[model samples]
Target: MKRLILGIFSIICMVTANSVQAQDKGPEFSKLDVSPMDLAIYRNDKDQPVVRVIYSRPQKRDREVFGKLVPYGKVWRTGANEATEITFYQDMKIADETVKAGTYTLYTIPEEKEWTVILNKKTNTWGAYEYSEKEDIVRIKVPVRKAPNNIEALSMAFEKANNGADLLIGWDDRYVKVPFKTAK
Candidate 1:
């Protein structure tokens, strides 16, 4: 009985040690790019655009190619490891409505006609595999556009526009745009 107890305790210690090592590994940041994209949405508030989405993403692996592998219509986690989260410095309007500023998980519903961008209440989750609709904070539909060239890798870019800049998501060389307006 004494030997059996000692063996079980040793196994438990080994298992715990392995789990601690795995947690310390975190996510493989070296294998991924952490490019930051800056976004600005102008509001009539005249306080400079209070709404900004600091976005970033990793390049797609050959097997994880967008559209071809991710497919046209599906729920995308929007980023790697932890869900793609947005930090709102202040409140902003979506389709002329109000959304308080804070960190939020961004999910998307991609379709040929229009793309639905969801601000989910859930944060720090792996891919959309465990996504729950109950965690949605907001859902806004946006238009999709065809790219002139093929983008083999997934990318997020913030480009300046005449009115408000675009937070662009490009993959398989295609792109989508979601416009925001400030509440008067």
Candidate 2:
């Protein structure tokens, strides 16, 4: 009985020591991203959200955004870090183009006076480096409107409209509005 007790105690001590050593090898947290991921949800009511956008917010940091860093006529991920993704809970008419209920990667082409907002069937992509026009579901042009004030970071929000809402994307000193209507 004495030997058995000693053996059990030894096993327990070994396990405890091993556990402590294993914990010492615990996870090393990665550094936070400079452009953090963000979300924008459009809800008509408390429980009924029609649209949700997941993207990253890139700061201007006193740099020129459009026609320079972003460049004209080139596809953009619509944000920083991972490509922007938009989800439609129901069928939606975006910029007068109909899209079925699903998720899509959002891209944009920044121009001098207008921007072409694109919705691609592909998802889980990083930047516009892998953008394919063949995968695009819809591409609509929206005129750039001067920002009411200088914006330091890329921002997106939904505003109530007659039938649905309008998605506003703004950065630096310019902004654009993309219309969204419920398919009726």
Candidate 3:
């Protein structure tokens, strides 16, 4: 009985040691991208967040962004790793088209002068490998503008407007704004 107890104790000790070693390794580092994960929230005057977006920012890293890394007329995941996701707390009119309140995957088709911003019903996708046009909830064309300065990392922001707000996507030296208004 004593020998059996000793054997069990030894096995437990080995497992504990191995677990400690694994924990010591700490978090894994991401290669190529150093911008970190980020969240953008747009709140109403009452301090309630009406819109939220979760995304991972990828650095330019000296590589050409538009028309190359993200080819023109092709669907882009809009961010690195997992496809960027957006949530609307209430029904809203995007580019004059009504969209129901729900979570969606945001994708884009980059062009030299304009971009097609897409809000797809599908969520939790990796990249644009599984994008489906049939799942799109809204597609809006927005003009691309030159940034006053280079933006190293990909970003999204909501700026207050008359009736609602403008969703801005910026990276490198380009940006596009999509208008949205709350449904009455």
Candidate 4:
């Protein structure tokens, strides 16, 4: 009877030790994403914040990017993985609409001649799958222009303009500039 009790106690201790070892294996991490996230910011000459954008950059990989991989006349997340997000540090005018200082999801409709840039109130969205026109704060049409050079990765940058700054989105051989008139 003592031998039987000892055997049961030893089995329990072994099982507990095995469980601890399993937990000690650490976490299983996922593979790297093909499209990594990126950021773009525009500031006034006074060093005050004007605007900021967070988005993912998808590679071209020698394939036709626009009107094919990314279809025209459809709302794109403006990047990859998660929908692009834009923040207005100050009250700004997009097109004719006045947008208050806040964060918004940025979506776009790519076309051969023009692109419809949208700023929606929705935040923390994964993709354009949840996009709704009702939540849009502003919609502006920006003309598509030929980029001087090819950009293999989806990229965004701000260039100072007369009114404020132009947020340029470039990929492949095409690019678009969205104008923002900021109070700053």
**What tens-digit string does per-residue lDDT give for candidate 1 at 60-178?**
54555656565668888665545676655566566655667777777887777678898887776777877899988778888878888877555665555544445677776568876
Task: Arrange candidates, best TM-score first.
Answer: 2, 4, 3, 1
Q: Write the per-residue lDDT of candidate 3 for residues 1-184, one digit (tens) a residue.
A: 9999999999999999999999899888768546577988899999998888899998899999998888999999998888999999999899778888889999999999999999999999999999999999899999999988899999899999877889889999999998888987
List TM-score per model, in order.
Answer: 0.64, 0.84, 0.82, 0.83
Clashes of 2: 0
Which residue ranges in model 4 land beyond 4 Å of their true spot?
Answer: 1-31
lDDT of each: 0.66, 0.92, 0.91, 0.93
lDDT of 2 by residue, 89-174 (tens): 99999876889999999999999899999999989998988889999999999999999899898999999998888999999998
Candidate 1 ranges beyond 4 A from true positions? 1-67, 160-164
Better-scoring candidate (TM-score), 2 or 4 = 2
Q: With candidate 2 superimposed using the best TM-score fit, by how many Å does residue 159's alpha carbon deviate from the native?
A: 0.6
- For candidate 4, lDDT tens digit of each residue in 109-167? 99999999999999999889999999998898999999999999999999998888899
Alpha carbon lDDT of residue 87, candidate 1? 58
TM-score of 2: 0.84
Least well predicted 10-residue stretch by lDDT in candidate 3: 28-37
Comparing candidate 1 with candidate 2, which one achieves the higher TM-score?
A: 2
